[model samples]
Target: MDITIHRPGELTEPLRRAWHRAMDESPEYANPFLAPEFAIGIGRHRAGARVAILREEGEPVGFFPYERDALGVGRAIGLGLSDCQALVHRPGVTWDAQELLRACRLSIFEFDHLVEEQRPFAEHVTGLFASPVIDVKPGDGGYPEWLRGSYPGLAKTTLKKERRLGRDVGEVRFVFDERDPRMLRTLMRWKSAQYRRTGRMDRFARPWIVDVVDHLFHVREEHFTGVLSVLYAGDRPVAAHFGPRSSAVLAAWFTAYDPELRYYSPGLMMHLRTAEAAGRNGVTLVDLGRGDKEYKDWLKTRELRVGEGFAARPHPVAAGYRLWRRPVRGLRNTVLAHPRLRDPADRLLKTVGTLRTSHRADSDGAASGRR
Candidate 1:
C-alpha cells in the first residue's frame, strides 16, 4: 500500500471523482461529512486540514481527512461538528494505522464518531456508543400518512399539537428546502441561545464555524447539498434545521426553534417534518448522531454504533497528548452514559446557565440605561 498526504484544496478533480466513487460504492461511506466537499470546506477555514490518499496497484483506494497541529497532534476533520468519521475506502482496501499516521506526519489521531467498520483502528477504540438514525421511506400520502404509519404512538399527540399550533399561532406550513440566507442566521442565533440555556458550548460564537456553515449552505452537488428546512406559522418561522444531505443520507446537524414556541414542541415538530420532506426528496436515512436524547430514542428506527478513541504511534507527543486528553473525555463519557450522574450534572449546568443569562440581561439593561 502507498500513502500520500495533501492539503484538501490540493486534491485534483480526478482524486475527488475517485473519492465520490468510493462513497457511491459503499453505503457506510455515504455521509456528507465524509465527502470531499466537506473536507474542502473545513480546509478553507482550518489551516491544519489534510487528506491522506492510499493507493494500491497504482489506483486510489482510500481517503482519510484530518487536521494536524504544529505539535503533530491530529484529529478528524470537523471533529466537533461532524457526526460521522471514517477513512473512506473501497471494499477490501486496508492499511496500517501506524503507517497512515507516519505518512500524515502525526504522532496521534483522535476521533469521537469513528465508524464501527473501521477495523484497522479497532484495537485503539476506547468505547462504543449507539448513534440513532431514522430510516425514511417516501410515501405518496404525504407527511400525515407517513407519521401515522411510522410512529403510531407519537402520531396523534404530535398531530394534535400541530393543529393547535396552527390555530393558535397561524396556518402551519413547512418548506423542505428554504433558500433564504436570513433563516440560516435565525437558526444559528436560536441554536446559540439554546446552547447557553443548556450550558453547552455556543458553536456559532466561533467565526470560522459560522463561515463554514454559510459556505456549505451554498454548496449544491450530487453527493452533498446543504438543506435548510423550516416550519412556519403564517409568515413566522417557528422551527428550523440546517444539515447536509448526500444522495441517500441526511445528517441531522444543527436544529433550533423559537423558544417562545416550545410549548408546541416545535423542535420535535421540526425533526418529523424534516424526515418526511427528506424522504420525499429521495433521502433514505436521517442520522440523529451519537447521543442519548429522549427524542432520538422516540424517533429512531434503529441504531448505529460509533466509537471514540485515540490512534497513536510510539512517540512522547502521542503519550503526553493522550495523558492530557483521555481523562477529560473519560469523565464526559461517564456523565453522559449514566442517568444518575447525567441528571445532576444537567441541573447544575442549567442553574449556572440561568444565573449567567440573568446577569447578562441585567448588564444589557444597565448599558441601555447609560446610553
Candidate 2:
C-alpha cells in the first residue's frame, strides 16, 4: 500500500472522480457533508487543506481529507468545524490505521463523531450522540401519513397549534425555495441574531460557511443541494430554514423565525413544510443534524448515529498527552452543549474573530459577512 498527500489545487480530476464514485458506492456514506464537494467547498477557503489518498495495487483504496493545525496536529479536513469524517474506502479493504497516520505525518489526530466502523483504529469507542431525522418518504400514505404514523401525538398537537395560530395570526402558506435570495439572507440574519442572543458562535459569521451556503443556494441538484423553506402568515415571513437536500435526504442545517411571531412557532412550521416538500419531492429522510432537541423525538421516525473523535498511536508520549487532553475535550464538549458556556465561547471567538472575518471578506461568497 502506498499513500500520497495532495494539496487542494493539486487535486486531479481522476482523484476527484474516484472520490465521488467511492462515496456513491459506500452504503454508510449518508451525509452530503462527507461528499467530495464538501471537502472541495471547504478546501477553497482553508489553507493547508489536503487530501490523503491511499492506494493498493495501484488503485485508490482510501481517501482522507484533513487539515494540519499548529505543530502538525491533524484534524478532519475542516476540523473544529465540518460535521463528518472517515476514511473513504471500498468494502473488504483492510486499512492499517497506523500506516495511514504516518502517511498523513501526524503526531495527533482527533474527531468527535467518528463512525463506528472506523473504530478498528482505537481500543475503545465511547460516547453516543443522537442526530434527529424525519422520514419524509410518502411511505404507504405519503408524508402526511408518515407524519401521523411516526408522531401521531406530536402531529396531533402540531395540528391543534396550527389551528390556534391561524385563528390568532392568519392563514399560513409554505414556500419551497422561494427563489428569492433576500429570504435566505433574512434567514441568515435571523439565525445570526439568534446565535448572538443565545450567546453562541454564529456560523453565518464565518465567510466560508456564508460562501458555501450562498453557493449551495444556487447549486441545486437532485440529492446534493441546499434547500430554503419559509412559512408565511399573510404577507409576513414567520419561520424559515436553510439546509441541504438530496434525492432521499433533506438535512435540516440551519433555521430561524421571527421572534415577534413566536406565538406561531414558525420554526416547527418550517420543519413541517420541509417534510411536506420533501415528501412531494420524493425525499425519504429529514436529518435534523446532531442534537438532543425535543422536536427530534417528536418528529423523528428513527435514529441514526454519526459522529467524530478517533484513536491515535497511543505511544507512551502520545498516550500521555491524550490522557491529559481527554478531560479538556470533554470539558469543551460539555460547554458547547450548554447555553451557559456560550458567552465565553463567543468571547474566545472575538480573539479569532478577525481572522474569521478577514477570511470571509477574501472569500466573498464563500462565507457569511459576520462571525
List all candidate RMSDs to the true structure.
0.8, 6.8
TM agreement with the true structure for every prediction: 0.99, 0.80
lDDT of 2 by residue, 1-371 (tens): 88998875676777766776676677556556666666766677878677888888898867788877555566777665545567877777777777777887776677665655675554534455666677665557644566577567767767777777777787777787777899999999998867766556888889887887787777665436777888877777888987766556667878899978777566776787688777777776777766666666667877777654555664554576577778887886687678778567766766565566566568885555554
What is candidate 2's CA lDDT for residue 239? 88
Task: Highest lDDT: give the candidate number.
Answer: 1
The residue pairs found clashing in candidate 1 are none
lDDT of 1 by residue, 102-191 (tens): 999999999999999999999999999999999999987978899999999999999999999999999999999999999999999999
Q: Which ten contiguous residues of candidate 1 have the minimum total lDDT?
A: 348-357
The C-alpha stretches of model 1 lying farther than 4 A from their native spots are: none
lDDT of each: 0.96, 0.71
For candidate 1, give the lDDT of residue 246.
94
Error of 1 at 55 (Å): 1.4
